[model samples]
Target: MSQELGITVKKDQNPSEWYTQVVQKAEMADYAPVKGCMIIKPYGMKIWESIKEDFNTKIENTGAENAYFPLFIPESYLEKEEDIVEGFDPEVAWVTHGGDKELEERLAVRPTSESIIAPYMADEVRSHRDLPLRLNQWANVVRWEATDTRPFLRTREFLWQEGHTAHATEEGADEETMLRLEQYQEVIEDHLAIPSILGYKPEHDKFPGAKYTTTIETLMPDGKSIQSGTSHQLGQHFAEAFEIEFEDEDSETQTAWTTSWGLSTRTIGALIMAHGDDDGLRLPPRVAPTQVVVVPIYQEDNRDEVVEYAEEVTEELEEKGLRVDLDDRDHRTPGYKFNEWELKGVPLRVEIGPNEVEDNAVTPVRRDNGEKKMGQDREEFVEEAEEVLENIQESLYNELEEYLQENIREAESKNEILATIGKNRGYVKTRWCGKESCEEEIKDEVSAEIVVLPFEEDSKPATIQEKEDHIDGECAVCGEKAERWAYFAKNY
Candidate 1:
């Protein structure tokens, strides 16, 4: 492959440039006309669609239905919830004029749909019979962040699915929040093949106005963390603000407990960083848009025979329920097709040359590690292709899981925390005092903040700190009594 067609920079040596080259060269996404924005191409959207389909199934199974909400939110609605509005103040984009006339009330683009969705839930929920109001929407939101823009990772406008639900009790809200968070873990780790640290954010750093926020943070190869997904237990905050009062069986009116969770297109960015190499992207087969691409190698003389045999192989894989692509483009050489498919990160490639066409067999190559299986009987190869795809998916995930496990190191002192994460650039598990001042000390010194306060095994976020069994050791930063188990890291 030429310099322009293939990745020109090594992934570790120049991660930023390597990412840009792969994103555009492999047809994932392109920079939009506006800075801080990107147009996700068909290839990139394919990955998001896979994420959506998987999560949608899990959500719908729990009685949540998909719904649509407006993009423009009235300023009055946002003001109803002071914490949420204040939380997004700097990034909120407002509209003062409508077409030609000046509007009486300003319109704020939806940084998130909590303000709008809460009111809608208020209208639909009236009594205990209408409890557990669950709704979600797949849409785009705008936040006018002026700096540090990148495609998918931190775009000004991006696509996501936000889930909003109302319940009669805090217990119901807790169950709902943990439920969605687990589903997000499945979507990220089980399907996307990216492992992450699961925990709740520190109180000072939880989502604004939320009772608590559960999150999944994944480490990138470049030593930055990705806030991949979040689930928030809203606990009567939005319900009180939006007047979502439902009547109980005893005829008492009460505010509903609410919860919200979201997973965004940024997962596409995570996929690129977690698995790509100097050659190009290396997709896990579970969510790869095209699992297998069969390239027919032939000359002008034997084109028909070779191409026909390749089609048979493609049909066999398709019959076995694989997303197979037959590269029968007459103009492009077999080598060119191989490079292009490899750049696109197709997990498995079958090179059907003249020799294999004559042998009534196929030669298979693994994209993850470039391993080859030569001269396997055609029927046997087709029968075993599904197993190969499964193994590739598992192998890719295990590689990342091991990397994440190896990098999570424990630290006891403030200097140790700074030196370890500053040089190593992964997670530092330490005891925190739960004070913003102590957190700021580290943030000011080396830019690593408390990313998570994890819950112990078989523990609940709401009651984890209240448990008496866990000990409160000295804080790593101030040497005061520690209050939480925290993971500190630099993030994107």
Candidate 2:
């Protein structure tokens, strides 16, 4: 492969450059004309489609129906929720004119749908029958962030599904919050093959106006942490602010509890950074756009025979319900095709050379680790490919799982926390006093903050701090009596 065509930088040496090279060289995405935005090319969009489809099914199963909301929201709507508006005010993009004329009331592009969705829920929800007003919208939002711009990671405009649900009781809202969070865990860990830490964001970092926020945080190969997904228990904040009152079982009007959860295009960035290598991307089979690619190796003399055999193998894999592509382009050489497919992170590649054609078999290559199985019977190869794909997926996730387990250092003091994070570039688990001032001071010093306070086994986030039976230690920063265990990390 040419230096310009293949990844130019080694992943371990320079992850940032390697990522940019893979995303662009492999034709996944390209930088848009505008700053802080990217054009998600076909390859990148396909991966996002996989994430959308998986999460959509899970959301719909929970009785949340898909709906569309306006892209431009009235400024007054956001003002209703002071915290939500304040949190996003710095990044909000405002529109003051309509084509040529100045508008009386300037509108704000939706950074998040809470302000708009909350009002709609307030109007639609009138009775107990509408207790669980579940609605989700797959849409694009704009946030005018001007720092660390990267494709899919910190984009100005990105696609995501924001779920807005209102429940009659706080318990119901809590259940809904945790339910969506667990589903996000499944999407990230099971389908994307990226292991993650599931927990509640510290009080200081919880989503604006949320009672608490649950998140799945994953570590990148470069040591920075990516917030893979988030679920927020909105409590009665939005509902009360928006006047989302409903008649209950006793016919009394009460404020409804609301929850909002979102998993965005950022997951695509996490997937690329998590599993990709120096060769290029190494997509997990389940979410890879093309699970298998058949490359026919042949000379001018045996071209017809080898190409036909590659098609036969492709058809066999397709018949077995695999997403297979037969690269029969006449101009590109077999070696070129292999590099292209490998760069695109096709999970499995079948090389149907002259020798394999004569043996009535194909050599299946695993993209994850470059393991090859030679001379397997054609019919048996399809069955074997299924097992191979599963193994590849499992291996990708296990590698990250082991990394996560090994790198989470337990710190007993402030210096230990700083040293651990500085040296290892991963999470430092420590006892925090649950004080915002202490957290602020620590952030000023180490540039790392409490990312999440993990729930104890069979414990809820609301009650975990109160239980106090599991851990007993002083605050790592202030030496105050510690409340619970939390993981701190430098983040993306």
Candidate 3:
């Protein structure tokens, strides 16, 4: 645990540098030869596996089946829906040749599986019985990005689960959209221990071809906003484009309503930014690859006894359903092991020394607060470890909750909104006559745009008279009456 091998920069001072150091030094991930791509190391991959298992279980319980789709899409298929193609065209990576032979129709590496999946759905779905087709795929996608490639944040290729569903009616599609978003919120907030804001993206910010997009936005420590997850209501756009029609009970053919939602490796970036500290990554207990690490402190006199006791404790903790690891390599010093585990950000550390062994108690240290508490009976220690992990999760969430509240400000005027965004580095809650022009104007003027238009539009506070008045006020940029209040921010 030398300074050179650990994070040297403070997060508050140089967050970008600090993050880079942590990711590499902690052996989480490594930069690949290709720019904008990273190799997920064993530790990093383990965390992702844990997250995937949890989400897979949740979706499976809700009747979603996992499936695989082609990784390449024909250019013509993508162009089936004009809006989707236009939105993704600039970012797509196309394969013009196959093994050196020129190809007639260029295939695009899947930026998303929508176009490829849609046409297949059209072929497979023929009647109302196949209406609610819920298919999810865990796959890799390529999006050719131009700038700022942070390991998990912005990358050329990344792993994610994209869930695509087709329903018989608009109401059913809407319900599916919200239900998936709710599940995402639960997995992120409760399991990942990250607090998030649920809202709808503005028309301009919605997914390329979606009728409307719902998202969960979480605030990072640096005050930037990270979109944790998103669910889109596809209306009849893709259904019509792909000719996915169903014969209803009434005997008429109608386009099926569709929805697609995704959660990506970027969520890992959010977790790092949200809860990590100078010590290193602070993973939530439920998702931590190693929830607890037992360091056996030994001396020549009691080395054997201390190591044996540590193994027993590790076995007991494992039996109690904890991911426990006993560090008995006999090579590293106790002090060194502590630093390594802290840098790796294990939620709890148990130090077993001769004194603790004699006293029948162990020393417990919490990663979040670095608080040391004397253990009790072995059974009690296991129970308290469980409680401590939960406490850490809650405390980490509350810390971010306070940050979100403090960073968000209610702005009354365009100038106020700009100033708030510039100074606070967070979102500005303001009244926007729901006009696309107003959103454009704000973007042009201050480079900040509407991120989310809350679903609970009518529940805005009464004190915001300007917002209420502008409910139909002329567009902030043009002269059209506003349609809704929006959360505006400069996004990553």
Candidate 4:
């Protein structure tokens, strides 16, 4: 393929540049006029719509409802929650004036919606019968990320869904937090086809004012970990801040428990790094915008006949409920169309020519592994196409699963921790004292921090306590007593 029309760098050699090329060449997105924002093209928007539609189904089953909220939040609302203001102060963008008039109070561009949404929840949740209230908003949020700005990964303005919920008790809040994390894992793994590790963020790294935060973390081909999704158990912190009180069955007033969870377009960056190759993106069939492209091959002599038959095959696949496209452009050669579809990561391609039209057959090629089946009878290929798509999904996931398994390693000393991250840059499980100072030491030296303190082998309701109880070793940094496992890595 020519450099101008295709990926110019190998993914393994220059991943940062390779990623940018694939995203633009595939027509997924483009950089906006704003420094740290991106314009989502139609092809990129379709992937996000698939994620949104799929997540809506899973969350709606748990009594969650979608709602809209204002983009601007007042300064008083943020000050009401001390942690919200403190945690996001450096990143928060404020509007000081309107038109030519100085505003009485500043408005925050909403680094997050906790301060604004909590007050709304307090107004609605006033009784035990009004418990387990869940509200989700699909919106854009802006943070002033002045350095290391990249498309989708760390953009200043991006789209996401933040779910704010109120419950009667802490147990209900915990259940809600873990449930959302589970649903996010399904979307990331089953749809995006990436492997993940679900665990707790160390206390210092947890969301500000949260009782605790659970995260779904995934690794990239470059060995850096990505925080794909996060579910925070806010407990009574937000409830008390906003005065979300309720009357219990015993006629006693009690403070409600609250939780917040979110998954963003950053996961799309994970999808690109996990499955893309030098050729370009390798989207799984489940979420691919165009699952199959039917490319017709013919010379001018028999172009009409070949083009007509290719349409029949396309319609057949469409009848089988597949997203099919017939690339019968007269000006483009079959070779050019193949490279285009492959760059866009269509999971499968069907090629037809005069030979197949006369034989009443079709040839199917797999995008995941480039395996081509020759001249299958047309009647049998419809169901076979579905089977091929299913296999491509599995193969893409398995490739990442194997890579993740191979990259996670164990470290028991400070030098070992630094050495491991310096050389490999993947997850390094180390015996930790649960002290931020030790993490700071490694981070200062190598720029790697604790990404996760894994949950116990069998414990589920988002427990780091059980995990804490099981570890017995000296601190990797201080060599004092240690009681936890911390997975350290350089993250994006």
lDDT of 4 by residue, 403-470 (tens): 99999999989999999999998999988898999999999999999998877657664455545657
- RMSD values, in order shown: 1.3, 1.4, 3.2, 1.1
lDDT of 4 at 317: 92
TM-score of each: 0.98, 0.98, 0.94, 0.98
Which residue ranges in model 4 land beyond 4 Å of their true spot?
Answer: none
Tens-digit lDDT string for candidate 3 (1-492): 677667899998999999998888778889999999999999999988988998999999997999999988999989999997899999999999989999999999999988989888999899999979999999999999999999998899999999999999888888888889989989899988888888887767789988888899988888788898999998899999999999999889989999999999999888888889998888889889999999988888899999999899999889888899999977888888888888888999999998888888888899999888875566678777787888988988888888888888888777777788778878888767766777777788777878776656455322122334445444444445566768888776
* Model 3 quality (TM-score): 0.94
Candidate 2, 99-218: lDDT as tens digits = 999999889999999999998999999998987999999999999998899998899999999999999888898889889989999999999999888888877788999988889899
Among all windows of ten consecutive residues in candidate 1, which has the lowest summed lDDT?
A: 462-471
Could you tell me the lDDT of residue 126 within candidate 4? 75
Number of clashes in model 2? 0
Error of 4 at 371 (Å): 1.0
lDDT scores of the candidates, listed in order: 0.90, 0.89, 0.86, 0.91
TM-score of 2: 0.98
Candidate structures ordered by lDDT, highest first: 4, 1, 2, 3
